[model samples]
Target chain A: MAEEVILLDFWPSPFGMRARIALREKGVDFDLREEDLLGNKSPLLLETNPVHEKIPVLIHKGKAVCESLVIVQYIDETWGHECPLLPSDPYERSRARFWADYVDKIFPVGRAAWLSTGETQEAAKEEYIQGFKTLEGELGDKAYFGGERFGYVDVSLIPLYNSFYALEKLANCSVAEECPKLVQWAERCMQRESVAKSLPDPHKVYDFLLVLKKKLQPQ
Target chain B: MAEEVILLDFWPSPFGMRARIALREKGVDFDLREEDLLGNKSPLLLETNPVHEKIPVLIHKGKAVCESLVIVQYIDETWGHECPLLPSDPYERSRARFWADYVDKIFPVGRAAWLSTGETQEAAKEEYIQGFKTLEGELGDKAYFGGERFGYVDVSLIPLYNSFYALEKLANCSVAEECPKLVQWAERCMQRESVAKSLPDPHKVYDFLLVLKKKLQPQ
Candidate 1:
C-alpha cells in the first residue's frame, strides 16, 4: 500500500501551492485538506504546526513537515529519483538552495508591502520594489533562476509570481514592465501543467486580497 | 590537495558565524578573508555574491555559496559524514530545516527589538520576549533544537545567543531568567569545543555593538 500523504492548505496560499506543484509534477498520490484562514483551524493543523499555526503542512507516513521550502526539499529528497527538483551535483544543489533561501527571505517583505495599507503599506511597497529590482538584476538573461532548468529555485519562486497581477493592481505598478525577464520567466512557468492546475486565476487572488483588506480595516 | 575555501566575512555577524561554526565543526581547512562592512568590500566578495554583497561568502573550489544557512548546509553536505551536522534520516532532516527556517524568520524581528534605543525599543523588546517565550514553549524538554543530538539547528542558532546579553542590557530585561530552558540549552551548547572556540565573548559583542551604535547615530 502507498503511504498516506496529507497536505493541509488554503487554495490561494503560494506556500501551499508549492507543495501541490511538486506533488503534481512528481505524480504523487496524496489527500488535500483545505484550511479556512479566518475560521477555526482543524486540530490536525494546530497539532501538526503548534508553533506557526499556519497552513501548508505536509504529512507523509505520519511525520509532519512545516515550511514550504523545507517540505519541498523533503519531497525532493524522498522522491528525488522520480522528478528531481534539485541537481545531482552537491555544488549545484547549494546554489539552488542559496537562491531558494533568498526568495524565502525577500518574498515575505514584498508580500507584506503588496498587501499593506496607508504609510506602512507605502513603506512595504518601497521595500518590495527594491527587492524585485535586485532580483531582476541577479536574474539577467537566465531562462530560470537556476539557469536553463526549472529546478528547485524555480519551484520555490514561480508560485509567488501569480501574485504579481494583484500587486500590480494594488500598488499601481507593473512588475512585468519593470522586470521584463522575471515576467517572461513567470509566463514560462505558468505554461507548465503543474503550475496551471495548482494556482487559481490572478483576478481571483486579487479579489481574495480585497476581501482580506476590507476585513482587516478598522470599523 | 583540498580545494581552497575562502570565507568573506564580517566579525560579530551571527549569519557569518553560522558558516564559521559549520566549517570549524566539520574540521574543514579553509582561508578566512574578512570584509569591511563600513568600507570598500573586496571585488571577490561583490563578484561572488552579486545579488546581496553581504557576508559571509564561502568560495570552495572557486564556486561561491552565499547566505549563511545555505553555506552551512553546503558544508555539511560536503563534509558532514566526518562530523554530521544533519541527521541521516529524511524526516529528521526536514524537521531540522523547519526549525532553522523558523529562526531565520523570527531572528530579525527579535534583533530589531533588541537594537532599538528609546520608546520604539520597548515595543521591539516586547516582540523579542514574545518570540522567545514561544520558542521556550515549543522547545519544552529538548536538549537541543534538533533533539538530543547537537546538529544543524544548534549550529544555526547558537551564535545568535551571543546577542542575548547585549539585548538583555539594552532591553532592561533578562531573557535568561524568563526563558530558563532556552538559556540552559544555549549554555550547554557553549560546552562544545567548536562552539566555545568560534563564539565571541558576550562583553566583546556588546562593545562591538556600542561602536556600531555610535557609527550609526546621527551626528
Candidate 2:
C-alpha cells in the first residue's frame, strides 16, 4: 500500500519544523497542512491531537502521531531503510533521547525569555543560556550531539535556529556570541538538504511574533 | 564479561521506583545504593549523574543512565529477552511514550497539590485530578494502559500509585473517589511482584514527607 503522509503544522513553530526535517531525512513525501492556531483552530487538528490540541501532528497511513520528538522517532522507525535518525545501538538511542529531551525543555524557557519581562524574563534568559551552555558542553569536540552522526538530537534542535533571529531581536540576546559552536553546528546542518528545506525564514518568524506580541499585550 | 548493574535511588521517590521496577521486570538483579538526596549526596551519585545530580541512575556495566523514563527505556533495550516493557510496534511505542509523558507531568502538579497551600494547592489538586481522569478515559475498560500488557506507561505510572496514601493525607483528596478506574488499574499493577517489591510503604512515605516538610517550611 502506498503511504499517504500529512503534517498538520504552523510554519513558524520550531516544533513543527522538527517533524518536517525528520520527514525530509527519511525522504518521505508529505503534505503540509498549515493550521490557524491563534484565530481559529482546525477541527482536524483538534480531532487528531485531542489531548494537547497542538500541532506538528504527523498523519501517516491514516494514524495520527502527535508530539514532534515522538513523530520524528516514528518517522525514523517507519521508514528506517536509510538515513536513520536515531542510532541502532540501545545505549546510543538512550543518549539521543536524553539530549532530545533536554532540547525539548529549552522551548518553554526560551519562550519565557522572549515573552516575559522584569525578573522573570531575566531569570529565564539566564537559565536558557545555561541550558545552551550545557548542550555546548555535551556537544564539545563533536560534529553533532551524536558525535559524527547528524541524527536525533540534531533534528530536535536545528529548528530552533529559525527562532534565533527572532529571539535576538525580541530578547536583545545572542546565542551566536554565547554558544558559537552551536551556531557553527547549525550552519553546518543548514548545508544538508533536509534542514535547508525545512526551516522558514527567521525574519518572517520575527515579524509574525511582533504582530503576535501586539495582539497578546497591547499598548 | 559479567554484567555489573547498580541502581542509585531514594526510597520515597516515585521516580526511583520506576527504575527499580524496570530492572525487576527485566529480571536483572542489581545492587541498590540509596542516595542521601537531602543530606550529603554520595560522590558516586554525583559522578554518575553529573548533569541532573539526581537519583534513579541505572548503572549497567559501569555506564550511568539518568531520567526514570530514559532509564526504563534503557533497561527495556538492554535486558529485553523477556517481559518487554515497551511494545515493538513504532506507533504503539509512540502512544506509550505520549501517555508516559503525560504521567511524568502529573508529578509536579501532584507535588504542588500536596506541598503548597490555599489557592495554589487547590489549583494543583484540580489539575492533578483532571490528569488522572484523562488517564481513566484513556484506560476505559482496558486491562492495562497497554491493553493487557503492563508496559512502559504502566511502569511510568505504577510508581505514583505508591504515593497515593501520602498524597491523600497531605492533600486531603482521593484518587479512589475521583479516578476509580485509575485506582483499580493501580491495584492490578500492585499485584505484579516487580511493582510490589519496588515501592515502599506509603505510610513510611507520609512520615518521610512530614519530616521533610518541617525541614523545608519551619514554624
* Best-performing candidate as measured by TM-score: 2
**Model 2 misplacement above 4 A:** none
- TM-score of model 2 (CA atoms): 0.97
DockQ of each: 0.75, 0.82
Q: Model 2: per-residue lDDT, tens digit, A1-219?
A: 338898999999999999999888888888999999888989999899999999999997788999998899888889955678889888888888988998887889998888888999899988888889999999998999998879999999998878888889999867778999988899999999999999988899999988888788778
Model 1: per-residue lDDT, tens digit, A101-145?
Answer: 777777877667666768887887777777777777767898877
Top candidate, metric lDDT: 2
DockQ versus reference, model 1: 0.75
Error of 2 at B17 (Å): 0.6
Tens digit of per-residue lDDT, candidate 1, span B1-219: 348989998878899888988998888888888898888988998899988889999999888998888898889888858668888788999988887877787787766665566877777777767777877776789998777877898888888788888876655756777888898999998998878877888999888887776677646
Scored against the native two-chain complex, candidate 2 gets a DockQ of 0.82
Candidate 2 docking class: high
Interface RMSD, Å, model 1? 1.3
